[model samples]
Target: MPTGPALRIDLFLLAGLFPGLTHAAALGAAVDYAVAAERAGFDGVWLAEHHFSAYGTCPSAVVLAGHLLGRTDRLRVGTAAAILPNRHPIALAEETALLDAVSGGRFDLGVARGGPWVDLEVFGTGLDRYGHDGFAAALDLLLAGLSGAGTVAGDRHRFPFREVAMVPVAERGLPVWVAATGSSTVGLAAARGLPLLLGMHDDDAAKAAMLHGYARAGTGTPRAGHASTHLALVADTVEEAEAALRRTMPAWLAAAGGSERIDGSAPPRRDAGAYLEHLLAIHPVGPPARCVRRLAATVSTTGVRRLLLMVEGAGERRRTLANIERLGREVLAPLRRLH
Candidate 1:
């Protein structure tokens, strides 16, 4: 089993696009956040992709990954997931290999089936189930291309130039993870020997069960260890932490596709306060010591090698910055010690 602390940072940060914030500002903040995260001693930072919504602004995670990889030399940059079905497998493989070359092999590609439901509609993915048949087909094609397995094509994947070699091949195998949450998806990833990029909402039991099932179902050694991200904040007191959550979480969750559109046509932004219980129950949202304990327990329980904390969920720019700094300086040390 994996040992020692491997705390990382994940940002789907949209504080810049909250109701009162400017979209340009949010994008700028995202760039700065990546730079700052590197400076603050984060292991890696993953960018999220979404479209046609206020949830996240970046549609092209590869573009952002290239930009971020250029900005920071030490911090590994990855896509929390780049929805694979949105683009062709060969194109994705070619671009991924090129980015890996440029980044000195620091990129980790996370592939996922469409989600937020709206994204599926937007991407025109034919998969009836998010983690089932269509996604599996795309993944097979993508992996084959990445592995330089040219001169072949699957029935579901129609491509050209069978003799043309997939160029800009990675210096080493480019680490790829299947972003999964459901049991079937988890089993699928395991069966294929692909590592998992698990979602944030699952509590300990669900996460543990996934691991158990993976061990039972996986075909071969997984390429990389599993990773997960969730809400994490550190304050001086529990009340202060709760207050910060009350201020920022509703907007954050809504941005995460947690709510629905009431009018039957668009998203419904629900009350952040209404979800507080759920948040507090699952995340490390308290004072520094409490935060460390929760994180340590999670690490101990799930054996998740990479734990990405969503400190930017607080929404307010200044508060988000402060939380990032403090968590890096404060909570991380104790958790590492625990590990």
Candidate 2:
């Protein structure tokens, strides 16, 4: 349970609007969305990284965060996740340090051990290399480098120490978050006391199980926060919300992997109607009152202190931003009162 005020609200921007979209347009929209989120009083703005797909245009979240920081004032910018296995820890540490310095210590570093079989193939890297041990090594290395401790020597590589400190270390150490999907990764994150960034695609049951496992594993030190990301839209009525969701769910589902049953047997065959309902089930989408209730229930059930809302979908950027503003003003405010 969060021992403070209402759960902190962060806005997430999926790099591109949908598959087959223009990269330039997506980048512009992402920057615009970050600015809008800041104006809406969001605590932070998260950018997701994906490669070799229209699923996301900004393949490098570090660079995207740099751009966003220059554009927005007082908004914490970060990668929803930068796949750690694809890059060396030293370089990643340098980039993140620079981001923190340039952003005036407002950069949050969220890392993951990549995702999907295809993403690994695109990078020409095998998951076997980074499975669990490599992830742990990378996490330790990044943290050590960020803390300006010493050269990090892992099972894979050894860094020569020559008084090389990762530049621009913030007065306070960076908040490191790990993106966890599987049980092993979740347990590792908890054991390390790193914040957990729950993936966007998992269902409610899987989310609950993961959270339970994390809680059980996280007994020692409480060094990290827990956050979950979900797509959301607020409208005048459930019917209107469903209609908007219906327009975007098919493409997103197809991109994730068509119609194949997920772990919980949710997301009925990749068809239009089924996919829309599946998305709504996993997200908060509806009128303000209904969405607030759903969000509160999700928070209570998952025990996540932070909620990252994905305001961008396959719909028009204007509509997405408008919905986010509506959520902030109407939905989130009342939910805060309840809390």
The lDDT values for all models are 0.73, 0.75
Per-residue C-alpha lDDT of model 2 across residues 40-119, encoded as one tens digit per residue: 77888888987765667788998889888899889888788988877767788888878877777888889988643455
Q: What are the candidates' C-alpha RMSDs?
A: 3.3, 4.3
Model 2: ten consecutive residues of lowest lDDT: 256-265
By TM-score, the best candidate is 1
Q: How many steric clashes between backbone atoms does each model show? A: 5, 0
Q: TM per model?
A: 0.88, 0.87
Instruction: Report how far residue 121 has shifted in candidate 1, in Å.
Output: 5.1
